[model samples]
Target chain A: MADTQRPLSPHLQVYRWQVQMVSSILHRATGIALAVGSLLVVCGLLHLAAGEESFNYFKSLIGSPVGLVLLVGWSWALFYHLCNGIRHLVQDVGLGYGIPQFVRSSWLSVAGSIVLTVLVWAYVLTPGGAA
Target chain B: MSAKDVVVKDRRNPLKVARGLGSSQSGVGHWWTQRLTAVALVLLGVWFVVTVLCLLHADYATARATVAKPWNALLLIAFVLTMFWHAVLGLQVVIEDYVHVRWKEVVLLVAIKFLAVLGALASVLAVLRIALTP
Candidate 1:
């Protein structure tokens, strides 16, 4: 972005991909996505507040397959952000420094999020009498 | 080393009342708030998702009942408040970074904060109305 067409510093192309890097970058990305997704929550809430008809319409829309897919994506994004956000909060307190600890924590966050998300969908898929 | 203290060519200004119109170029405050809210959301956000998931597949009445429960309602309120706080904080940074038009950026930031706060408040009220009602 300077006068000359020089390559950017700390660019991703030159570096090897790592879990910690993925977790850190994805955390911010998901945070932004979840911020957008929160608007959907507002819409849903307002629709429910508006009236029964509006709430039913909103329900049907979100109950559709496409909506379910988006919900699933948002769910994962939420979990990922939550897990990595905690990792970041820990880092804020001056803990989890060093390469080994960083990488380990990154994997821990990824695994935790996945397991938690699966458990959530599992609960969602649970039938009435199957519990 | 060149010891030349050159002037900022157009650095003169009329003796107006206040300083510059907008915030200064020292942009650390936005970054700090974003991180602060991010820290709070980490805990509140996870609790929210897990709680909602547990209520999944439940009927309308069951879901309402779950939310009406004391502990669940408390966490729900906490989650919504912390979430909007984190969201407005994050969006403020995004707007500040991208929206080069200063006035527009400021307007959008203020608007986002207002909307987020309103959203949070409405959600809290809805939860309370549900929890307190029959």
Candidate 2:
């Protein structure tokens, strides 16, 4: 009995791709990313608290090309998670439960996040603009 | 008496008792906390991002002064705590779902809690140090 093989439940391979599925998965994926990003926040705070020299060094690290790439990815992830998280909160309040609404909201989260990421980056890259 | 008439107690598997229902018996506490932290994070997170953006072009003294503002310092502390709380709640679910090994799951879960606690404390101290500095 200890060696008995139990049947496995249906997995992602069996299901057709859908907006809801993608949104759900992305929520978790971006969550993990943000968890890592939080460390950077801690690092920034620590450096800033240490002194101007340390703060400048921290700024340089983040201003480097590789750092910029990671920052871009992190910002996009933050936007996506925030948008999708709002959708989830709405669902928690008992709205948007219908299939059509669920799908629509899923897509809305995706689209809204992209729009936000673009807006933020646009401001970031513009001359004399806030990053 | 026949075998069917005998008063034999039927033992049930413990796992079966918790099969459909929540095991912790906290009855939605975890779910509610996750949502509450999420809502708090939404407002705090927006403020935090904007604050960071404002600091992008700021020099060290300027950035320090910005963070030293009473309102900014208060909200920064609020943001750090809420963000870490929400993060732990979310990560716990991810670990529970994916880490099938019982020992590994428990260790990971406990590890995250400790890490979040340490991160929160360090962040708060850092904020206080910045805010109180001349």
Candidate 3:
């Protein structure tokens, strides 16, 4: 057969945005984000091991504005991935295949993550909390 | 015709030919490990978040003392190792699915593995240093 260029099947642009799609995409997006966040973990460990001076520097860096932003983003990402990942693991075992259930769970993942993030930040900002 | 005298040609479409023949035999292992590590992470990740939160405003010596504790040090090591393992597996799938260029895909996959391994080792070493030293 002759080689030919063929238009690919309808892509993301062709689909109407929906919760299910958003949840699916966010799972991957947050997964990627958390993967990058893993580097921060290594840095913290190394600095802690290095001694008081290095550890103090690492602490201040993460306490800065930019670091707080990244921390907040990663905390949300972690929660979202955690919630959605559990949903996925459940689905893998043959439950929640119904469309309505799937949609509900998708929304649950999003809502749950937001709530967790807010609660965490609230605690962090509270006096005598993580701050 | 005698078997030696006749050749059977595979005339199926390329897609059909490739169907069910694409398994490199390691895919299942990769998938299973990813899930297993994920399960581990769920527990470890929560523990880690709480631990860090507890140390939020702790001074350097206090933070060092907490990490130097036996159980915290052990779980911290486990958490970092599993985290990098899970991250590598997840990144590998993302690269495979999205990076269409053959060479770029291979380079990324290799690069991610090397980085994850180095990161994991560094974390383990650091954890050991914290745990072992006074």
Candidate 4:
């Protein structure tokens, strides 16, 4: 198999980076991240059911620096995936097929996700807001 | 035409040849279900975020009580199930597309399903415990 070199179709390295590409790639990446993050949900529920001590411990763990960092990352990932996923759903319905519309929607997904993420963090950081 | 001239060359039926070669007729089901779950998650995800935010700084007892509420428990269970279902479907597509090695791909696909199923089950059980207990 090593002896015969076959010409492979162009992939990531071959194409110039564009918003469409970035949006498509990030959708998958964030999806995978969120999939892994689902485990955190399971852990939270389990601890809550266990007892007060366990619940507090779980809260503290998530409140720690590293956990906070991960939480932020997952928050952004969630927003990004949600926005881009909606874009995909719209495309599936046969809208936004033109090149200009396509490019515009791609940027919309990126910008929308960022704005949403910022809004979420702003709320979390404000007084009386949850982490 | 003569009967002999019209004899089929392939012994196996057409369905046999097509069985493993193309979609098992489940591809559309998978794609449709993924979209359906995505739609469900949009509502549930927003509800979950708002609910958690409302519980901000709540003590353990308050948090537990909130979760034990009827609507909260029902929605949480729905969210957990839908999220896992959507995650598994998305991950399956990713694994199938990227993992080239047959054995590795099969192992990963199966592993993710197992993990998602267990995670969903555990979350549901935990919610039930919270909802059922005083």
**Candidate 4, lDDT over the whole model:** 0.92
lDDT of each: 0.75, 0.90, 0.91, 0.92
lDDT of 4 by residue, A20-97 (tens): 999999999999999999999999999999999999999999999999999999999999998888899999999999
lDDT of 1 at A46: 56
User: Which 10-residue window in model 2 chain B sums to the lowest lDDT?
Assistant: B18-27
Which rank order by DockQ, best down to worst?
A: 3, 4, 2, 1
lDDT per residue (tens digit) for residues B14-79 in model 4:
888889554786898899999999999999998998898788788999999999999999999999
Docking class of 4: medium
Off by over 4 Å in 2: A1-10, B1-21
Question: What is the TM-score of candidate 3?
Answer: 0.90
Error of 3 at A110 (Å): 0.4
Model 3 chain A, poorest ten-residue lDDT window? Answer: A1-10
- Name model 3 segments beyond 4 Å from true: A1-10, A129-131, B1-21
TM-score of 1: 0.73
What is candidate 1's lDDT per residue for B8-99, written digit by digit as tens?
44455643524644465445675677677776676776676666556455455666677778998798777777788878877776676556
Q: Which model, 1 or 3, shows the larger DockQ?
A: 3
Query: In candidate 2, what are the lDDT values of residues A24-106, reduced to their tens digit?
Result: 99999999999989999999999999999999999999999999999999998999999999999888889999999999999
Instruction: Using lDDT as the measure, name the better of candidate 1 and candidate 4.
Output: 4
